[model samples]
Target: MTRAEEQRDAGLLDAFAGHLALQRGLSEHTVRAYCGDVLTLLALLPHGPDGNAPADLGALTLATLRRWLAQESGRGLARATLARRVAAVRCFTAWAQRTGRIATDPGGRLLSPGPDATVPQVLTAEEAAAVMDTAREQAAAAGTPAARARATRDWAVLELLYATGVRVAELVGADVGDVNLAERLLRVLGKGDKERMVPFGRPASDAVEQWLAARHHLLPQQTSDPGALFLGARGGRLGARQVRDLVHRSTALAGVRDLAPHGLRHSVATHLLDGGSDLRSVQEVLGHASLSTTQRYTHVSTERLRSAFTQAHPRA
Candidate 1:
């Protein structure tokens, strides 16, 4: 592509990113992924008459869209990746057509493989309790003020993760004001910037209160984001990566199968369903956009039930 063509594509991507962020309310990570997919699709388009520049949006036909997906499949991309790419192109084409850049939305007719059906890994309720207990034990054993603060924060993190089933992003993104300790509720901004109130248990609330008491130990002289509900060693807002590391470390200490923060989310959802929480209620707490997404926990519950039956049934 010529320099001018490359700049044009860059400008298009910039505009599309704004649309995804401001209009669609997608998260920054998702905006980047969608933009990257669209960029790849644009690069794969047939050359224009100049034979150097890539074809314009006008060339985004259904055939070209399908060809892009076929090429990605050939590259051995996962089904979920392909599906996201399809969504990206469709979003792009619809925007292009609306803005008069393209006469038609070719991506409208395109299709891709569905998301993978593999079940997520989760800890049993007993295992979850063990993880929380381990975190509390670590806090109690800490000898120094800084160590105690960090350990207390980790305990709070694990308790909140299991109690609310909030995504790691949501937990890390929360502020001090977002928590209602007295009411045992947390306000989180979920994917798509959707806000929801999730109720946690007393254990989580008490852990958070303990961490709050010790929070100043980690506060740096020049702290960043002092209002953050959770703080790192440097006194900045807690990050998703830090939360993930804590989850892994705590699980290992608990002598359980190590899982990421997301696995903890899965474990909470499964436990809730197992304990007789309705699907709609779980959906609301988890901030799932679709009820169908919440239904996956039901499958996990069923699998557990089946395993127990096979192990204990006399008929077998």
Candidate 2:
């Protein structure tokens, strides 16, 4: 039996996910979703060819696959849930055939989900202002130098996120050298480890100045060394988890419950469109590989329009 024949279905799914991570350079979340889709397939198939022999996933047919999906739907999976699963299987089957694991691709006929009609959540100008105000105020409350330095750091973090619309991972992954304060630009390593230069506005530049000036006061030990742009309490390189917690802490202190860092990112895109920024530029700033992702903000804009109409219109 061939290597594909010898490996169990679960093992193959894991290997495929690894391929996505190592070769395709996909992020952890995308890898997980892909693995999960194959897992759903594995569960539907009968257990193994014995350990030494190749497992017969070769029997996958359009009918069996459709039936499996139908069962999944019957279990009350949402349209989006069903849609992702279909995508997962399609990706796997394509890969499997290309890699010669399967002679026929099962996903050639798989259908995609309908367009996502749900609107994305976005913060209003007032709420965003409130959150920023609270962060600045909290930063001010800490009388110690270290505390004040942290406030500067937090402000920079919030400001950049709000301005650039980059994901939290991209933000924390940024090195000190990647920030070009003079040019008002930030270099980010986004999904797939792709590097891109994104620009921030004056507010973010001011925040960066404060953060950098006080940065030495915060991590005075680093005079010659240049590393991650953000540092944690330990003065070492900051991790993504810490940044996430930092945003969460600021939100909680700001009295905004159920708010996520991405909300601010979303706000940036929405606010830009609301301010007459074009869809293409918003897409570029957000590092979206597809304009379709950025187009979601238009839906957000429409909802805001409807809201304005409801509040302002004097209809009977």
Candidate 3:
């Protein structure tokens, strides 16, 4: 529409962001991410698109794009981050083609970044318990000694995430009314706003009930309420930032140096598989839109075989 990244209309990025917001109903965060991803590619362009090369939107080639990605790798961007950038580029070019800005996407044949294949990091069981304990103490010190009750809430959130392997975004998006405590199920709202109801074990159920009984202390109203299962101190509703900050701060206090918000979700799936839960079951609990995404949790094949050989062979 604007002459193929021609005039550097400064408003182009904002326009795309607005389009994402209005047309896709994407969250502000997502719109920004998409825009950022596209801008990153534009920055990598030689002499830019409109003004310079127009053959392929500034004659950007697959090799050129790969070089940009390689530069990103050299700069020490994490594999996951680089992968996201690739995906972002792909999405942007697709959008460009769809919107008729470019006849063909330069990113169409671009290869995905290599995956790091590092077993995703996570908190050990004891470490997770310690983090929960720390959060409880903080909540208690903040006001009432409602620590156990508060801890009950954190534990439910932590355990359910770990046990069910759902994303923090999904967990925070859960609603009080959506959770069927009697049935031990929580309806998780996922990306693209897809919904699924996942069942949890008794420990998670007990913790959730404790939180529910004390829920009024956290959320004082239900009429026209936000209906979120989790709440922040100010008490509107909890957000992913709050959840990540909660985990980060609590784990730091407990000295679990490598914990992350998604770590608990990773731990859940890995633990389930370790405890002999089938891969399909783990995949479903994780709400992985695909099975391949869930397979990363199967960190046992090589390690397990080594352990079996070492134990059974006379070499040891």
Candidate 4:
């Protein structure tokens, strides 16, 4: 492939990615993953017309895709990674066929091993309480106005995370009007552009109230759109990276295992199931599109129960 052909291939990939983002409603993170998988396959194939880049999607074949997967496996990629690659290729092939770019989908019969069922990390109630307490203490001991604002915001961030089990994107995407203090409810726009209302407890509500009262400290002095629920030091909408950094810092201060926002989400779902919340209810709260996706937490609950029995029974 010549440089021009490579550019065309790259442009096609970008077009497919845009389709996934706008037409398919996939989140940016997911779209990026799909693009990465496709790019890996493109890089593996022989060069195109100019012997510099891979051929176009219309030239793809089942043998070509299988070879790519086999090569990845030979290189020691995980089952999950291989499976995701297969899915990405299949999605792209189907799109190509639909768009008249191909006569048939080469990845129609492609398959890979299923991912291993690994349990996600979950924080116990006591551990979660300690995290919150640490954030609260930080807020109380703030030496400056900015420090106090951050401390308060951190507290609210943790509380809302644990209370609602919302993803980091949803938490940061929230607007000031999305929260209802009196009703203890939050309107969240989750993945796939789906909207759901999740409830929080009194502690989360109180923390948010404190942050709301003093949140202006974190906002820019001459802000135009003042409806963001959370703000950075520069008063812009809080990005996902900042929220992740804050979670890491808070967990470190509490001297507990470091947890990402999704880990906090897992903790809440596991705790809810442990406390007798039905699987469907947990699914609804987590905004999962399928019950099977939510069923993994049951395994966590079962493992915890078996562990308790092993420690207490002592019959062995």
All predictions: root-mean-square deviation over Cα? 2.7, 4.4, 4.7, 2.5
Model 1 agreement with the true structure over 115-181: per-residue lDDT tens digits: 8776678998889999999999999999999999999999999999999999998998899999999
lDDT, candidate 1, equals 0.88
TM-score of each: 0.90, 0.82, 0.80, 0.91
Residue range 138-201, candidate 4, lDDT tens digits: 8889988888988899899889999999999899889999999999999999989999999999
lDDT of every predicted structure (CA atoms) = 0.88, 0.79, 0.71, 0.87
Looking at model 4, the pairs that clash are 1-50, 1-51, 1-52
Q: After superposition, how far is residue 277 of candidate 4 from its true place, in Å?
A: 0.6
Which residue pairs does candidate 3 place in steric collision?
53-58
Clashes of each: 0, 2, 1, 3
Model 2 residue 307 CA deviation (Å) reads 4.5
lDDT of 4 at 203: 92
Better-scoring candidate (lDDT), 2 or 4: 4
On residues 77-174, what C-alpha lDDT tens digit does candidate 2 reach at each position? 77877888888788788888888988899788977667567654667787777777787677667788898988888888988888898998888878
- The prediction achieving the highest TM-score against the true structure is 4
Order of quality (TM-score): 4, 1, 2, 3
Q: Which of candidates 3 and 4 is the stronger one according to lDDT? A: 4
Could you tell me the lDDT of residue 157 within candidate 3?
A: 71
Model 3: per-residue Cα lDDT over 1-316, one tens digit each? 2454544634556666767778776656677777776665676665533455422344456777888788777989888788888987787667777888767777889888777777667666778777766655554555563555566567667666655778887788778888887888888766656678788878677667767777667654553457678776646677778777767766778888667778778877767776678888877787787887778767644466578889999986
Cα displacement (Å) at residue 105, model 1: 0.5
- By lDDT rank, best first, the candidates go 1, 4, 2, 3
lDDT, candidate 1, residue 163?
94
Alpha carbon deviation, residue 212, candidate 4 (Å): 0.7
